[model samples]
Target: MNATIILVGTELLSGMTIDTNSIYMAEELNKYGIEIKYKFTVGDNIKDIVEVIEFGKDKSDLVILSGGLG
Candidate 1:
């Protein structure tokens, strides 16, 4: 199955922080025979997040979003 990873945080896009979660998730998912086909980083903007989520959902069997759930 294909997966899409979206890291959502303004700090991430601003280069204030490096994203390690996606890398870890990708590696772990690969062990389960899941392929991550696309990765994206979006800021705190709702529109951009929504757009990426829609795209991820449409293109991948599973979509994983990390960071800023609250």
Candidate 2:
């Protein structure tokens, strides 16, 4: 299956914090034969996060979001 990954964090956009979750998840998913069609780094905005997820949903079979929980 194909998937899209959305990494949400203001720190990510500002480069203050490095994102390792997406990379790790990507590797694990790859081992299962899941192809990642898109990877997006969005700031900690609810609207932006939802927008990306909606876009990914339309373009891929699965949309996975990580971070921005604080």
Candidate 3:
């Protein structure tokens, strides 16, 4: 399986907080034989999130998002 991970939140883009979720997820997915094609860091913008998801749609069989809600 191929996957893409989208990190949401302006803090990620601004470097306010360090993200470790992707690292863990990558390791877990790797063990399952899932190839991670792209890791996208997006600010707290709906348009940008959708755009990133759209881009990943063609490249990945699975798309995942992490970080900051509300």
Report lDDT (Cα) of residue 8, candidate 2. 89
Number of the top lDDT candidate: 1
Q: What Cα-based lDDT does every candidate model obtain?
A: 0.93, 0.91, 0.91
Candidate 3: segments with Cα more than 4 A from true spot: none
Better of 2 and 3 by TM-score: 3
Predicted candidate 1 versus true structure: per-residue lDDT over 1-70, tens digit per residue = 9999999999998888888899899999999999999999999999999999999999999999999633
Q: Cα deviation in Å at residue 18, candidate 3?
A: 0.2
Which clashing pairs does model 2 show? Answer: none
* lDDT digits (tens) for residues 1-70 of candidate 3: 8999999999887878888889999999999999999999999899999999999998899999997742
Compare candidates 1 and 2 on TM-score and give the better one: 1
Worst 10 residues of 1 by lDDT: 61-70
What is the clash count for each candidate, in the order shown?
0, 0, 0
lDDT of 2 by residue, 1-70 (tens): 9999999889898888888898899999999999999999999788998999999999999999899543
lDDT order of candidates, top first: 1, 2, 3
Candidate 2 lDDT trough over 10 residues, lowest sum: 61-70
Ranking by TM-score: 1, 3, 2
Residue 39 miss distance in model 2 (angstroms): 0.4
